[model samples]
Target: MRTRVLAASATGALALTALAVPAAQADGGSGDIRITKVVVDGDNKVTIGTGSAKTFSVSVTATDDSGIAGADSFTLAGPGYGFESTGKPSCKKVSATTSTCTASVKTDPRTDYLSNAMAGTWYVGVWIDANDHDYVWKDKAGSFKFQRGSALTTNASPEPVKKGKTLTVTGKLSRANWETLKYGAYSGQSVQLQYLKKGAKSYTTLKTVKSNTSGNLSTTVKATADGYYRYVFAGNSTSGAITSVSDFVDVK
Candidate 1:
């Protein structure tokens, strides 16, 4: 497999990159190779946390007088991220001329090859070689996007509190760091505190708080009724917004 290292901006934008395609065989005729479908992580959306792995499945329909030997290899490439092998696909013979190939891809921020990959649209490519002849075919498989995700946690101590007593709420905020392929504290960001009555249709924001140096949160509110409390993070360009599961507090 070929390898290259590139860098991305803070916003996850990629720099210029290229892929090298082998020259076609001079005498061998091009075979009929078609990429019917391509699915990444079981869908078109290719979302990955920092330092994560994803699998891809490609369906190929090949028709030729000569028998199909199946796919030779598959590749996933995009802006911010360069060409990385999905490894050789495992093809299952459906008939003399048709087969399906499945493969997996890993993005490790620690590894130099994929350390610069940003979250965005990526293109897939496939190569096929015929068993009966020197004929080979290479074509585009499909496209998908890589997106960052945020993590949030919340806790309300002394769950059962007197109606007029102060209820303490605490939480943390973090987001995927593609450079490290891990979730790190997201500090100095605004997070909303919301509350929902036991049977209410929706939650209403009570106040907004900024995450501290360690991404920790702490605040207090008067206990008035039975309801649920949660924190919502409004994500930025590089990451997607996420909300913590509601923590219930019972008021006497």
Candidate 2:
């Protein structure tokens, strides 16, 4: 999406914070295989109302202190069941004593290929090169799984705001792309607006309102000063942070 950059001071620090499984047997030899940690960035856990092309950074780490004599190579395989993998995993050598690698993947990064894939539960599996068939490293594999929530692809544009004029900021909301949970649980969800003065040190809440049956929400944002203002639309809690801002306006 297109976003307008503003000169407003950041209200607070921004925190940028993925997949799956397989039918592979564990390596009885214990080659120090593991998934160090999983990092989910940009609305990973909560739904923003509209279907979002969430981006995640998955990191996998492997180490071998068993004195195994061989070239320790690793590979990652995800059923991808229905979701899409941005590209091949980006591998890196964290350390000789400890081998580590990381990859960046997204459920749906582009709006062009939305229907080509299904939003469902997917599996991610990691493999180590050893005595395995087809060099598949099936002998040593680890797996994890996660669900994709509902998502919205509706197009939106920044609404124009007049300087010193109070404008009700309103927009649509949708679930995550892989959302399969019953809508009843998430229906009537609310979208929060976070507002702050231009160049201010902190952000304050403007309003909190639930979406209409059509998944639309509206709230007012008062332009405190004539210079500039930016607000974000988010779901759940006061932490509703806006990922983009409206267009700048000349008060005079």
Q: How many residue pairs clash in each candidate?
A: 3, 22
lDDT of 2 by residue, 113-149 (tens): 2221232223334443322211223332333333324
TM-scores, each model vs. reference:
0.58, 0.48
lDDT for each candidate structure: 0.68, 0.39
Runs of candidate 2 exceeding 4 Å displacement: 1-22, 25-34, 38-58, 66-91, 102-123, 129-166, 174-187, 221-223, 227-242, 247-252
Cα displacement (angstroms), candidate 1, residue 72, comes to 1.9
lDDT of 1 by residue, 1-252 (tens): 133335554677544444443353222346555455667666555444654444445444455455567666666666653566666777776667666677776554445444424566666666766676634444455776555668999898787999989988999998777666678888999999999989999999988989999999888888889999999987764556789999999998
TM-score of 2: 0.48
Q: Which candidate is the best by lDDT?
A: 1
